[model samples]
Target: MKTALLLSGGMDSIALAWWKRPELAFTVDYGQLAATAEISASAAICSALDIPHTVLRFDAKALGSGDMAGTAPDPNAPASDWWPYRNQLLVTLVAMKAVATGVQRLWLGTVASDGIHKDGTPEFFENINRLLSHQEGGIVVEAPAIGLRTADLIRQSDIPRSMLAWAHSCHKADVPCCHCRGCNKHFETLQELDADVATGD
Candidate 1:
C-alpha cells in the first residue's frame, strides 16, 4: 500500500516522514511566511530518506480570504506568523494529491504544541480526517505527531540534526529567529527531550 506524507521539512514533519516506513513524501509549497527555503529544506529531508517526493505549489494568497491571510501579523500572532486556513488548505491539498496519486494513507506532522491554531486548538489529523472523509475521496490525514510531543518525534525518527540546520523557522528572517513562536516552540520541543537542535546545547 502506498502512503503519502505531508512533509514541511521542519523538525516535526521530517520526523514524521522518517518515522514511517518507506513512502512517498508530499510537500506543499504554499506561499508560506517563508518561501523557497522551506521547500528546499523539505526536499532535502525527503531526499535523505530516499523517498519519492512531490512538491505542490499552493497559492494561499489567492485562496485564503479569511483572517489567516492577514497582510500583517495579528497582535495575537507571533511575528511573521500570519496565514489563515493554512492547515485546512494543506490537508485538503494532500487529500487531492492522494486521490490523484493513488496513495491510500496520508500523514502529517502536526503536534499539540502548535499553539498557533486560530481556535487555540491544534486540528490534529483526527479532526482533519473527519472533515476530509466527508469529501468524496477516501484519503485520510494522519498526524502521528498529534499525541506525541516534538521531543517524542525526534526520539523516534532517524533524521539527523544537521538536516535541520537550514530549516526556515523564522517567519520573515532568512533563518531561525530563535525567539519567534515557531523557533521557540521548536526549541522547547528539543529542550523537553534534551536533544540538541538549532541550539548548540
Candidate 2:
C-alpha cells in the first residue's frame, strides 16, 4: 500500500514524517510561509527515509486572500499560525497529489492538541475526507494524532533525539523565534516528551 505525508518541516509534521518514513512526502510552496528550513529539513527527512519527495507550487493567495493571507505576523507570536485556511488548502492539495500519485491515503499531523486550526476537530477532517471521497477518484485523509496530545506523539514515535533539535517550530525564517505560540507549543511538547523519556516511558 502506498502512503503519502503532508510535510511542512515543522515539529508536528516532521514528527509525523519520521514516524511514517518510507512513505513518500508532499510539500507545497504556495507563496505563503518562506521559512527555508522547510526546504532543508524536509529534504533531510525524505533522504533519511529514502522516500521520494516533491515540492508543489501554487498561488495560494490568488483568491480573495484576506486575513488568511496577510494576517500580520506578531514578532512575539506565531506567524505560521496566521495563514489563511492553510490547512484546508494544504489538504486540498494533498488530495490532488494523492490522485496524481495513485495514492489514496494521506497522513497529516493534526494532533488533538493542535487547537490552532479548527480546534483539531474530527468534523473538520471528516468534512474534508467526505468531499474527497465523493469526488470521481477518491482519496482518504487520516490524522493518526486525532486523539493524541503533542507529548504523546513524541513519546510513541521512534524519532531520534538529534533530529528532534532540527524540527522547526518558528513561523519566521532563518532562526527560531522562541516567543511564538507555535514554538512555545513545540517546546512544551518536547518538555513533556523529555519528562516521559526520563521517567522510562
Candidate 3:
C-alpha cells in the first residue's frame, strides 16, 4: 500500500522495519539529546535495507521532559522520556509528509510494553488513524508491533543481529550509555533472545 515507517532507530522500530519493510522511513529529530545518533542509525539501516529515508527536524525541546531532554525523569511524568503527546506529534508530522508523497499507510514502532503511555494504546492509534483518514489523503496510522514485546518481535521477525546493530537506544547519549531505561530494555531484550548485540559507535 505504499507504506512509510516512523523509524526511531531503536530496537522495536528496527525490528518493525525489518518486519514490515516499508517503502520509506522517517526519522524525526524533535530536539532529543540522542537525535544525532538516532538519525544516523536510522539512515544507515534504511540505506542497508534499500529503503528511502528522510529526517524531519524541529525544536520541541521546550516541550520535552526527562532524560531525553537532559532532565531528570519527572516523578509525575506521563512516562519515562515523556515529551507531551510525543507519538501524536510525530504521527501528525509524518502523516503530513506521507500524504504529500503518495504514501497510503504510516507505521509506528509502539510495542506491547508501551501501553503504559496513553498514546501507545491501541485506542490512540485507532483514533489517530481516524483523524488522519478523515483528511484528504486518508493516510492510516498503524502500530504493527503493539501486540508483541521487544524480545518477541525480535525473535518473531528473525531480523539479523547484524542489521539490528544499527539501532541506538540510549536517550541521553549519542553512544548508548547502557544504563538508561531505553538502553537497559535494548540490552535486556537482546540477552533474553540470546542475540549478540553490536555496541559502540
Candidate 4:
C-alpha cells in the first residue's frame, strides 16, 4: 500500500522517515513558530532520501495557544508547548491531501514522550483511525514509534547522524529558542543517544 508520513522535521519523524522510507512525506506549515525551519529540514531530508515531499499551509495561529504560536499557554494546557487539538487538525489536513494522492497509510511522528498530551495517546490514534477508515478513502493512521522514546526510535531506525542532523525541534522559533520544551527534549534525546553509544548499548 502507498504510504506517506507527517514529517515534522523533528528527531522522531526524521528517524521514522529514514526507517520507513515512505513513498511520500508531508510537512504542514500550520503557523507554528518553527514552521520555516521545519519545512526546510523536511525538504532537505526528502531531497536526500529521494522521497516526494509536499507542504500544506494553513494559518491557524489565531486558534493556537502556547509556545508554538508564540502566545500564552491555554488554561487547560498540559504543557507549555501544548496546542489544543493540534494533532487532530494536522491529521485531518494531511488525510485530506493523502486521500487525494491515493495514499493508503499515514504515519505520524508521535513518540512515547508525547503521551503527556491526550492526542498523542493510543486511544486517540485508534479513534482517529476508525474515523478515517469509516470515510471514503479508508486511510489508516498509525504511529509506528508511539511505543518508543525518541532515542530508542532513532536507534531502532538506524538513521545515520548525517540525515538525523536535519531535524529542527524548536517549538518557539526557527532559530531554536533553547529554553523551550521542544529544544530541551531534542537536546536530551541526543544526550541519551550519546550515552548509549558511550556505554556500548
Candidate 3 vs 4: which has more TM-score: 4
CA-lDDT, candidates in order: 0.67, 0.71, 0.89, 0.94
Looking at model 4, the pairs that clash are none
Off by over 4 Å in 2: 61-70, 73-80, 197-200
Candidate 1 lDDT over 152-184, as tens digits, reads: 777777556676554555554446657666677
Q: Per-candidate TM vs. native?
A: 0.79, 0.84, 0.93, 0.98
Going through the candidates in order, what is the number of backbone clashes in each? Answer: 1, 1, 0, 0
Best-to-worst order by TM-score is: 4, 3, 2, 1
Cα RMSD for candidates in order: 4.0, 3.6, 3.7, 0.8
Name the lDDT value of residue 98 in candidate 2.
70
Model 4 off-target regions past 4 Å? none
Clashing pairs in 2: 68-84
C-alpha positional error of residue 50 in candidate 4 after TM-score superposition, expressed in Å: 0.5
Most accurate candidate by lDDT: 4
